[model samples]
Target: MNATTQDIEQLGINTVRVLSADAVQKANSGHPGTPMGIAPIGHVLWAHTMNYNPKNPEWPNRDRFILSAGHACMLQYSYLYLTGYDISLDDIKNFRQLHSKAAGHPEYGLVDGVDVTTGPLGQGFANGVGFAIAQKHLAARYNKAGFNLFDYKIYAICSDGDIMEGVTAEAASLAGHLRLGNMIYFYDDNHISIEGDTSLAFDEDVAKRFEAYGWHVQTVADGNDLKALTEAVKNAKEETERPSLIKVRTHIGFGSPNKVDKASAHGSPLGADEVKLVKKNFGFDPEQSFVVPDEVLNYYRGKGDEGVRLEQKWNELYQSYKEKYPELWTEYDLERTGKLPDGWKDKLPVFDPAEGKVATRKASGKVLNAIADSLPGLIGGSADLAPSTDTNLDKYTSFTKDDRSGRNFHFGIREHAMGAALNGIALTKGLIPYGATFLIFSEYMRPPIRLAAIMKVRPIFIYTHDSIGLGEDGTTHQPVEQLISLRSIPNLMVIRPADANETAQAWRVAIEHKDGPVAIVLTRQSIPVIDQSKFAKAIELEKGAYILSDSEKEPDIILIGTGSEVALLIDAQARLKEESIAARVISMPSWELFEKQDAAYKEKVFPKAMKKRLAVEAGSVLGWHKYVTDEGDTIGMTTFGESAPAEDLYKEFGFTTDNVVSRAKALINR
Candidate 1:
């Protein structure tokens, strides 16, 4: 008797479920229940619903799949192996092990098919929104009369934990408002959390909530119902106006008779006996593990073959498009490879000291618009703080439902979602996405920033009101700890430019930085542009820390500062000259970039002989010890600031030339 297609399909799905359970049981860790429950969803997506080429995971037009519930990464790993991605079965067996491709969660660069690094629940959900926005923008910009080059959709499997995360709520609201028709999500409505049934805490009309969010909603009664899952995906694909969410009710630990629908199987491995029972129940040999029947392999590989054919057809269309629209083709190619056009950097604005005082944020606005046309993929917006953040692109129209080709974005007041969405947009090849808000509100964006660092993706974060400078808003609005807090995050480049020229150079560094994320902290108050002819050129800002004004002889003391404080130090250097004191002022914009320099270069900048040093910054003085040394002292905020003007706040907080010179004298005397 011959086995039918349905029989092979069910076998393929159960094989993943059994393999997943076995890996967890062997590792003695990981969530066994979600994987066992969502095997059908995984199977339906990889084998039936999505368009992806296993042979080339980086194919730009492929449909993206994000596992929002990253604890259930085994489900993704199993399917990735079965579908012939670069991940092997051995890699799957070594789940959660150090240096293994199968990390505890799906990390973007580690695994071949993992699109974004996701573990903190709703971040991946928000990333899907970014991916959707990228698809729309690219489709509108690149797709021609006969070519649909960017029509691929973004998909994600979100769990109840994801739904409960605040970031997801923010992302969902924005996705609905934008009518991201290219986005579809699978909400895994497994009623079990680590505690117990969701009834222990959550019991709300989720479908109605999504409906209210302007999303097209659907429900599949059973997780095991492959036809229903496929049909739901079909319906979601048909809704081309609003983003779609299909809520599927699943039984956690579906095959473990005792742990089924129980929280016991949520984060731990099923016992050995229960694993045997699961294998036996699934009609597989209980003794044998990680068993993938030859027929099931053929079935999934056959599905992968479909992607090859589809991509071939697309390649043909792209060839014709390249010929028909040569100029557009060049721009598209540049975006795809993330290469800037020839002489694009020549467009960067150079500020003159004679121009008077200019806020770094204002200079940043000029820099953004200066090169906006040169860098087609340079697109971003502020989180409803464009006027204050100075993040708007002047020449372009706004990117809205009506116009997707616009470079400017209005992320509204959703910083959490904006950050998460920027991560998604960064993952999309050919786009450099940035988002902005006040420095104090960076607390809302820390998670996404950390994840972006983990993924080593490029997403420029423009943080203005960088100190107690935006004074009238008071202590609550001022950021005394944000600079040091952001600096603490590994792989994140935190730069606080001193003047307009340095701010312009910071933008150049941000555009050229290929590694992790960059945070450009700007000032709300005006700062005098340093005279380039009298001191070093502003291009020296790329070195992270540079000597702005050096003493004719070996300096008696070193004065260090970042952002606005650099101006104070420069003035202190001048005042110290009158007192017959030789003082050198150093502008240290980025510690991460400075650390990357060689030891010899570092020693040259901060010689061990120079024990008399003083550093000034408006933010926390905590991390300054590394630069100032034990013998040196720093003039910075030791406590929260008050609601006074910037000048008074600076005076009250001791960020002044007199205080700096006094601190320098004290340091030298010590």
Candidate 2:
């Protein structure tokens, strides 16, 4: 408010703009326009609104900021550097350089202050919703009348590209329906994109759209008006019942003399001449690049240091809270540190083969219910497919607008949004979140699933009705290629458990898995649970591939299978033995996990000396050759399935025991 303070604020904002331009120019790649345009927004957030401790970026209750329009990540990097986060001035200089924390996009674990990895448009927006959901749930579960232990707000800066993406629509709808008041998004309405002006495609009133979604919407006519931006954020904070969107009309390439408001400024860096001009326009020396005035750096750092005192105050209150409610505090301490309760693994269900046939999806449901009480912070639901996917937590109530304490979530029929939101939830410390849909629909969620993999976040993606096993759903719903497709992602662990017992162990692996997302592919039709007494223990599921049943002799052939097909392999192996032929059966649930095993273990599972192999599965045979050597053959669906019964579909797709036996005989002869 004072003259000196106001000058420093303006100087800080300009420094952000200039620094962003320099970084992009240096990298020779990246979107520089939006950062230059939205520097004031960043200035306002750290200096005026957000409560975050740079000294401790892991502070549990600190407000979260997501750069949803992640192409403009230099904006976030500028703020992170200025605010005294672990990001250094040299880090800015090394933007987009190999191994630098300043990645082209804001990566979660790679960067100190970034809350989630965001690159695909609208993912960050949905992630913000997830962050809001986590905050609300944590607050409801832990906060007493005065403690307010988990009242952190979730903030994001989105752009025209993000607003135009369909994921934001689903996420915004869900956020509004849940009445997540902790969410505050700034829509950067620059009206420009890579192709051309947004009017070429998007020209609708964003405010009215958000209003229809039940969000409290406000518009600031200018991005540079710090007072108006601050006022809008203040108004958003006061509305404690609905999520808020403050549309800030920013200018693309705000300070660049020639490139302002042009599509040319959107993706590529402003040229060297334009960069100098931008500096000159912002009252900086045209010759200087990456320049940060001492006053500007000190101003932002001072704002960041305020968070230390705020956290200290919270720490004192937390100590009192501990004394007043020791039991709750114990839970809080455990949850915040992301530690599972002692002996939580013992609560997982162990299925009996005598329980008759059970669908893996149904088995997953039992596992979820069995473990729900033990892991208090685990929460999730389906994309309105809970009944079919069997992903509902049976022992817990649903998480709704009125009750945030419930563990179950109804993510609606929005797979993509649910996928994006799951990333947000997983990024939050102490919370393990899951989402479900049919494996066929997993294609709709590729963006989020792949993003989660790239970030190495562990969000359990439970997809039921894997392959053609769902029956009667026909070709449109049957997922012939889905299994192999999921396996293709680098860091994702794709598991298709064989039976009830294997399904239970798959959930075990899912819960314990870290640093990457897990895709639990399940069948809709019932299948025989492997008798653990006669076969290898289901606990071997962690090894990814194992000998479920073996021949007595140095066997003539090997049969490998996953999920429902594993049962067929078992039946085939028995038939082969009756014919005076020896056969070995291997259960391979996850290719990614198997690849992680040492060479000796891998060789033991699929010995190089015994090369004659046959594999069976009701999905695409894409990646099976790695295990089934060049001398082997695979019986897999190379075409779509029909609307027949699951039994008929299995026979039609060559997924029966007879088919597997025939394939093994042929492979042995070859």
Off by over 4 Å in 1: 1-3, 536-538
**Model 1 lDDT tens row, 1-670:** 1459889988988898899899999889999999999999998899888999999899889999999999999999998888889998888888888899998899998988899998998999999999999999998889877788988999999999999999988999999998899998999999999999999889999999999999999999999998899999999999999999999999989988788899999999999999999999999899988788999988888888889888999899888998999899989888788788899889989888897999999999999999998998999998999999888888888989889888888888999999999999999999999999999999999999999999999999999999898989998999999999999999999999999989989999999999999999999999999887887544578889988899988999999999999999989999999988999889999998899999998888899998888989998999999998888898888899899898998888888888888888877877
Candidate 2 local Cα displacement, residue 216, angstroms: 0.5
lDDT of 2 by residue, 1-670 (tens): 8999999999988898898899999999999999989989998898999999999998988999999999999999998988899999998899999999999999988878998888889999998888999998888888998898889999999999999999999999999999999999999999999998999998898999999999999999999999999999999999999999999999999999999999999999899999999998989999988889999888888988999989999999899999998989998798777677888889877778887999999999998889888888789999999999888887778999999998889998899999998898898888999999999999999999999999999999999999887899799999999888889998999999999888888888888888699999999999998887986444599999998888888889888889998988888888999998998888999888888899999888788999999988889989888888789898998988999898888888788888788878877877
The Cα error of candidate 1 at residue 131, in Å, is 0.2
C-alpha lDDT of all candidate models, in order: 0.92, 0.90
Candidate 2 TM-score versus the reference:
0.99
Q: Number of clashes in every candidate structure?
A: 1, 0
How close to the true structure is residue 442 of candidate 2, measured as C-alpha lDDT?
98
Model 2 residue runs over 4 Å out of place are 536-538
